[model samples]
Target chain A: MDLFEYQGKQYFARFGIPISKGGVADTVDQAVAQAEESGYPVVVKAQVKVGGRGKAGGVKLANDADEVRTHAGNILGLDIKGHVVKRLWVEHASDIEREYYASFTLDRSAKKHLGMLSAEGGVEIEEVAVTNPDAIALIHIDPVDGLSLDTARSWVDRAGLDEPARAQTAELLVKLYTCYTEGDCDLAEINPLILTPDGRVHALDAKVTLDDNAAYRHPEWDEFAGSDVEDERETRAKERGLNYIGLDGSVGIIANGAGLAMSTLDVVNQCGGSAANFLDIGGGANADVMAAALEVINSDPAVRSILVNIFGGITRVDEVANGVLEALERVHISSPIVLRLDGTNAIAGREILADHLSDRLVAEPTMLDAARRAVALAGGQS
Target chain B: MSIFVDENTKVVVQGISPTSQGLYHGLRNRAYGTHVVAGTNPKRGGEEIEGIPIFATVAEAVEATGANASFISVPPKFAADAIIEAAAAGVPFVVCITEGIPAQDEALAYNRLVREFAGTRLLGPNCPGIISPGRCNIGITSGDIALPGGPVGIVSRSGTLTYQALHELSQQGVGQTTCVGIGGDPVPGTSFIDCLGAFEADPDTRAIMMIGEIGGSAEEEAAEFIATSVAKPVVSYVAGVTAPPGRKMGHAGAIISGSKGTAQAKMDALAAAGVTVALNPTEAGEAMVDIVRKLG
Candidate 1:
């Protein structure tokens, strides 16, 4: 779950990381008020989850209330890489002496926590990694031992930070590590962590991606839920504990696992049909879950046909068939549902569904055949 | 010899109880002829799950039953600690079927194993475990869909897709030596490369089929390994070509962030490595069949 920049800044502040004084404005009037509160010379930055806000004219510097209102109005509705700006982050502009980069993320290859600190900042880290690899100081910390203040100081030294800013930057790195670990962030990046003429250091930008798996531990994460770009179908599916993604197509997909659900979408497209949504019932494909999945997909106006693809692993197919039958009694689906059940009592499951086979409820032996049938039923690709 | 598990592999199930999902699969594995020797639960120390003895700790379970491999099916909160306990108890290989374990816990478990228990290999904290078809079934993969004594070896990131690849191959009258689900998480105890290297070393396995999805460089790294290290015929299928950017797409690791970890990139990497990259699972299975026919 990616957080808006303003939210990230606020999150960093929660961990005692110094951030520029800022206020989030949802309206143009609020933007002017925020600029006045910040004492002018504020940066009216568009709050979107994409990069190049400056290039897209979404970022502007305002010296006064009039300038704040003008820039805020222009950036509030501006689109950066297809993300329409609905919020503005008005922050007091910093006096930058130099820019440096710092971040903490998982090193999937090493299966460890990786921290990168670079003297070079204010640009994509990937570019620096490719062009001047030595410019970035790479450190792999064990999640068990995490980052230490002493280790962070040497890392800052390795990154060739100025002597005056070294201690503050090192201190900030420790705090950021805490934010990454205790905060349950998948990534905590501060590009262009600025060094002021007064020898103070602070995060000029924050890009945070929280780990959704850790939401169970932190109920406070519910506050970040408002920024999520979820649709009605997704919210309904979430209510039923089904993993569903809304897509703009005619065929609705229901599968047993993540890999299979994604492959189901690809197969539907291969059969010349687009999917309306991607729904994974996971291990429990019981009556209530099946009924809830059907109700969510059935609500989609684009859905013309549904494909139920279940391959029993921990999930038993015969029981899943019974669940589907029970689900049919609860939810009245408008479109046809093509069922393809295999693995673990699949024959018995097929035997159970044999009596219910009809124009509305059909079963195919193979996923390819089931997908083809679903696509044909949905009137093919548009 | 099969990779990971074979007839000689004695198994100890952690967190197994009469009503737990661990016991449920434990019975199924025993029914399939696996040596589900002992179970460990602190609370149910003397209790048994369908005649399988339960011990208080993995050390006791391992000592009593001589179990070399451990299968974990604990809840999310305790799943990592279970893996750590199994590894600490000298279980050389641990496969965790429990899902929703926090990334921090998984990372801690993974790092701890690599550092302290260098000999132990953890397969997953949230995954469908491995099956060496007709020989040993580890976790939740349905043994009925698997066929034994064949040339093809399979490994996948997705559970159902792993089964789908097996079903697609078995339906075409082909069989697999072993099929492994590495689990679709940000940090898996095992990787595609681990299973690929094992398959490459196994003489009975002639060809390999790999199923990958979006997120992480596991697929790309597997491609590099296949290009340089592996000599067997490799066919691959990468899911999530249609998955939109920045969405979770069900799996925790199955998301496209920014411009990285796309299906196309992984597929391109695999193809460049002489892997038969199929656009879909069915097509991938068919490609493997073609490879098998040519080998014949």
Candidate 2:
């Protein structure tokens, strides 16, 4: 769940972090109106999830309404790293005396929440890390203890921030940490934590990644869900409660687990067939779930043959076989299905399917054999 | 002779009830010769599920049954608290089988486990729990495919892949000593290195098979550990070579971010560490067979 710059700013403002007044606009007229409300000299920034918006010319300084309209018109459809900008964030431009970088993210190896602060900002932090490592201050904070003001002040000092900006930056870091933990975010970053010539400090840009698992607690996250661009097949699969990813091939793949599903795709390619999609039924291979999965895969006209590969663990192969039978009866599938069953109760499951085998439905014993059969059915010579 | 669990390991089941997954797996574990001593459910205190008495708290269950390990199957919302309670109750090893726990909650729970319960090792909050074949079967892994006192030790990040590898090994008549699924979450309790170290120390375990996927540097770190510390023959298979970038592939941890956490990177690291990198699941099993034969 990556947030647009406007949404990230709104999220940060909830925690008392100061951000420039901004309005999101989808049209040139709306961008001009927003510039008027913010009193001109605005930054019409393209709202995309990808980085390097400025480098891609998706960001421009608008001194007046005419400039805002021109910038907005150019940036609205601009593509940065394959993401077409559909929205523009109009914010009052800031007068910055200095720029600094601050971010909070989980360090997987250290098993702690990592906070990075650097006096250098506005450029790639990775470049700073490689060239002058000492310019950045890295702190690993235990989630239980959290970020204390004392620790934050020391971190700011270690980063060699200016003396006058130290207190306000530390105060803002504490609030940002609150927004990170309390806001249920995987990452809360404020690039170019700007210091005004008047000695005021505030966040200039926000990049936040919210944790999807924490959606149960935050009902407001539905807005973010609404903005997600989903493929039709992916949307249908989500409605059916199946884990699916659409691909560009002829063989539709269905497996039991994530790893097995991925391996299924690889093996399908190995057997001289490309996979049309990756669908994992998970531990639930019941009748209703299987029917829904089959319907979703069958809806894809690109699929020439379906591969049902099940390696049962706690999930019984007999139950999955019964589900496959029930699903075959429910859905009017156009493509042939190649089934491979193994693990617990696999023998009985295969026996149940023996009576139902036909030209459209075939059963193979090993995964390799099933993949080969499915590839052959998909018009590939295996 | 086995790692993590054996005949001597007494188990306490948390979130056990007639309808809970805990009760279901707890009974199966007991059937596999594990000592299913007690259960804990605050509302169902003094009640019994399949003849196992339910206590009000983990401390009571631990005290009464002398349980050292805990199997947690509570819902995601209550999973962190359940783990905290088990760790606080002095359980040396806690395996949480619950998925979808908030990452923040897991972070706090991990901190508490490290600071308060220093000796306790949490296996997973979204994993198929550990299994010592014919000794103790914990969590949802089907125990029938694994054979006790076998020469191979298996560690995996995915559940069904573990089952597939186990099935292939069993079909080839190469049994296992202990099989551990470290889960597929971004932040797992036990790591590949942790399990690899245990397998390296166990004398009954002659060879090791590791299954990993794209995501995180845990596999890379484990490869480093295998190069320096482990002397046993190690075979590895990493999934998601055909997977696209920046997509979560069913598992929360199986996503490729930027250039890191790719299957190729992990395989390269393992191969550099002197591990046999298998191209597919069957190849991984065959690699294990070849290693076991050489050891014999």
In the range A235-282, model 1's lDDT, one tens digit per residue, is 888777788899999999999999999999998988899999989999
lDDT of 2 by residue, B1-296 (tens): 78898888999999888898898889988887889999998998888878999999999999888999999988889999999999889999999988888889998898888888899999987888889898888888888888777799999998888898898899899999999999998789899999999999999999999999988899999999999999999999998888888888888788888787999999999999999999898989988898888888
Candidate 2 structure quality by residue, lDDT tens digits, A1-382 = 8888899999999899999987999999999999988876899999988888999999999998889988999999887987889999999999999999999988888889999999998778888988999888999999999999999999999999999899999999999999999999989999989999999999989999998888999998888774655468888998887899988999999999998999888888888899999899998899999999999999999999999999988788999999999998888999999999998899999999999999999999888899999999999988
- Looking at model 2, residue A85 earns an lDDT score of 90
Estimate the overall C-alpha local distance difference test score of candidate 1. Answer: 0.91
Q: Report how far off residue B8 is in candidate 1 (Å).
A: 2.0
* C-alpha RMSD in Å of predicted model 1 compared with the true structure: 2.3
Judged by DockQ, which candidate is best? 2
Which DockQ-derived CAPRI band holds candidate 1? medium
Those runs of model 2 whose alpha carbons end farther than 4 Å from true positions after fitting are A79-81
Ten contiguous residues with the weakest lDDT in model 1 chain A: A226-235
Q: Which lDDT tens digits does candidate 1 get at residues B1-296?
A: 68989999999988877788888888889899999999988998877768999999999998888999999888888888898999999999999988888888889889889889999999976678999988999998888888898789999999999999999999888989999989988899999999999999999999999999999889999999999999999999999999998888888888887788999999999999999999999899999999999999
Which ranges in model 1 have alpha carbons more than 4 Å from their true place?
A27-37, A66-84, A130-134
